[model samples]
Target: MLKRVLLLLLSLMLITTLLVGCGGGTTEPETPEETPEATQPEAEETAAIKMAMVTDVGGVNDQSFNQSAWEGHQKARNELGVEVNYVESNQDADYLPNLEQLYDAGYDLIWGIGFMMGDVILEAAEQNPDQKYAIIDNAYGDTPSNLVGVLFKAEEASFLVGYIAGKMTETGKVGFVGGMDFPVIHGFHYGFMAGVKHANPDVEVLVQYAGDFNDAAIGKAIAIQMYQSGADIVFHAAGGTGDGVIEAAREQGKYAIGVDRDQNDLAPDNVITSAMKRVDNAIFNIAEELKAGNFPGGGTVVYGLEDGGVGIAPTSDKHVPADILEETRAIEQQIIRGEIFVPDNEADYNANY
Candidate 1:
């Protein structure tokens, strides 16, 4: 009886041990199912570029240099995805402040339009060495390494227009009206006179300066005086003031030549043609270069006939003769090919005269 009892106890202990081992092997706390590490997305990057322009005293919509420069900045904004802005300078004193405001606002490129802003641009560029800048029409001495100076051989186009004036004149007299007394403005006068002489050596040119760019009344009065004095064609380089010259030509039934931009459409019947300086093209090219990371610096860039920087406007379908158009094109080709030289400076003018 004692042996049977011991055997029963041994069997019970073996059964319990087997149960514990099976549970441990099959169902141990599932090593807390390791979860995938959480991931984060990378940030996107954006382009950083800005441009600004300071207009001349005549303002941004002056239908001349200021307007052209503004158009260039607008182009940069549209094509390059850049931020752009502009400030119109009402007086000479406003130039530096306007440029400084743009620079302080973190603009990468700043442009000053017109020769009248030459000194202002120089001063601003010197003070703001970290900023890139550009000036049109004149370079004030040696520009800083961050500044670009743009000038055009406007005399080439003026000479062509003057030739047309000389050929079309019924009277032996022609005239020139300048916006200011600056050497830059005088270049137009000098070239026009030379062209007239080239076409008709006996023709006389009466020259006058309006001293202001926006005074259309003064321009009209001056133009009328010239017309009454037996001048058949009067060429004007007087900015907004030149509008008066066209008006005078229309009133007097005489011919007028426009400048800077094509004014033939202003009075298609009276404006024979315009001496185009390609100011818009210059601004556009400069802005494009800046966008391409090739900003011109520390030097003056002079664009001429070969670069399409200067040319005569298309002959008026309303008034310009086909023969005159053909002859003008022939002369233009000669000038571009170095077969003809148009004078700009006073010394050159005197020598040619």
Candidate 2:
């Protein structure tokens, strides 16, 4: 009986050992499974950075300043894996609020599209020193260290377009229509007039302002009047209002110069050339710098003919004369070499004229 009891005790001990070994084998697979979940939290932490832009009154699809800037923002988002958004300011009052909304949303970069936003951007930049911002076509007098101002030498390209208009005009009279009376628009006027004078000093250029960037009717009326007054070519620096100028040129069988983009397509037969402003390149460069952790702050960045920021559009299938094209190219080279100074202020325009 004692032998039998000892044997029973040994069998019980063997069963207990087998149970412990099975439990240990099952826990080893669970340990490897938990290791992958530990790595998943790190993957979730790597998210994209956010960038935003606030458009001027003309909105994003103006096919002008707003459109170009938006394209640049998209380029950065795609190439750098950034998240992007844009707010359109239909009224001037929306400028500050739009920028503020973007900042509050934790966007790293907020771009203000035009010079009209200069005052609003200045005030906002001062209030939010921690946020980085960029303003195009204008610079504030007292910009903060976190803000960057992009200014363009638009006159250089306008001058080239003016030369084309001067030589192409069947009538000795030409015209210039501006969106508003800002210095930026004035730069276009001054440069164009200079180019016209350079080509034909005796030619008369009729200048008019639409007084509003968004008013197409005013643009049409001014363009029609210019066309009726024996003007064969009308160069318009107006935004959406410039659309009216293109329409008038097409309807009247007259030539028109488009601004900001390659507007030749707006009226292929009627458009001579557009004074191109590389707003896309400017915004792209700024975004790239911001991504690289190097933001240009507290100073104005001027992009001119030498920097590929401004130039005349390619002559279309309608064809400008070879001699005229040659002359404009020569002037472009001179402008780049600093031999020609296209004025930006009213004083220079008055002095040169």
Candidate 3:
């Protein structure tokens, strides 16, 4: 009887344990497995570097370097995650204030777009020694520690386009309208003249300047006068003012060569080609170099045909003859091979022209 009681008690204990093992007839929701993304840590992102350019009175839309520089800046922003901005100067006095504004805002890089800012850049670069600065078309002989200079071998391109103008002109006449009489402008004048002479030794070339880069009216007036005075083709290095030269060429039924950027679209009929200075490339390259930690600071970067800095635009594809285009390509190769040395200064112009 005691053994039976013991077996019955053990059975009762086993039944209780089985019931508990079955969770006491209760149910619980399922737990999902851990996902890989949920276990991943947050990534650390690098902040973008801020950069900006200050335009001369020509403003950013001048479709020249101001425009080209802005395009390059935009491209850097797109490709390399750079933060870019621009300040447009409406007058001469605005250059200083515009430059200071960007510097004070703590821009990583500030660029001045024209030679007109040479002195002001010098002054600002000196006062703000910690601030980085750069300028196009002008090289400071004694540059500040934080400043970089961007220059071009514009004469080489001018020579190529000048050669085109010499061959294309119907009246044995061509013209040039410049933004200023600065050394840089002289580079264009001398090279264009030299190229024209190379193409046709007796082609009569006319030249003038607007005394300002912003005055399209002055440029147009100068261009109309030249075109009417028997010039069948004109080339202009006058920033926005050159836009007027395009108009004058159209109205006068003449051919024109553009500068800084391609002006062919302004008047396809009138523009034979454009002398390109690749300002966009310069600005983009600067941004790239700065971000790559290789900033070419405290010195000038001179870009030329060999450096892919200067050339004639393809707008002339429709205008340039097959043989002449082939010849120009050969000339470009010669320039690159050091067989053709183009002049860049007044003395050299005198010697070569």
Highest TM-score model number: 3
In model 3, where is the ten-residue run with the lowest total lDDT?
33-42
Clashing pairs in 1: none
- For candidate 2, give the lDDT: 0.88
lDDT of 1: 0.85
lDDT of 3 by residue, 1-353 (tens): 99999999999999999998988966676888867565666787877899998998889999777888888899999998999999989898999999989988989999999888999998988998888899998897788878999999999999999999998888999999999888989989989998999999999999998988888899999999998899989999999889999999999888889998887888998898999999999998999999998888789999999988999987779888988988999999998998887997879978756
Model 1 / residue 62 / CA error / Å: 1.6
Name every residue pair that clashes in candidate 3: none
Clashing residue pairs, backbone N/CA/C < 3 A, model 2? none
| TM-scores for every candidate against the unseen true structure | 0.86, 0.86, 0.88
Give the deviation of candidate 3 from the true structure as CA RMSD: 4.1
CA lDDT, every prediction?
0.85, 0.88, 0.90
- Encode model 1's per-residue lDDT on 138-214: one tens digit a residue: 87566799999999998999899888888888899999999999888877999999889888998999999999998
**Once model 3 is optimally superposed onto the true structure by TM-score, how far is the C-alpha of residue 286 displaced, in angstroms?**
0.8
How far residue 7's Cα lies from its native spot in candidate 1, in Å, is 23
lDDT of 2 by residue, 2-31 (tens): 999999999999998999877844554434
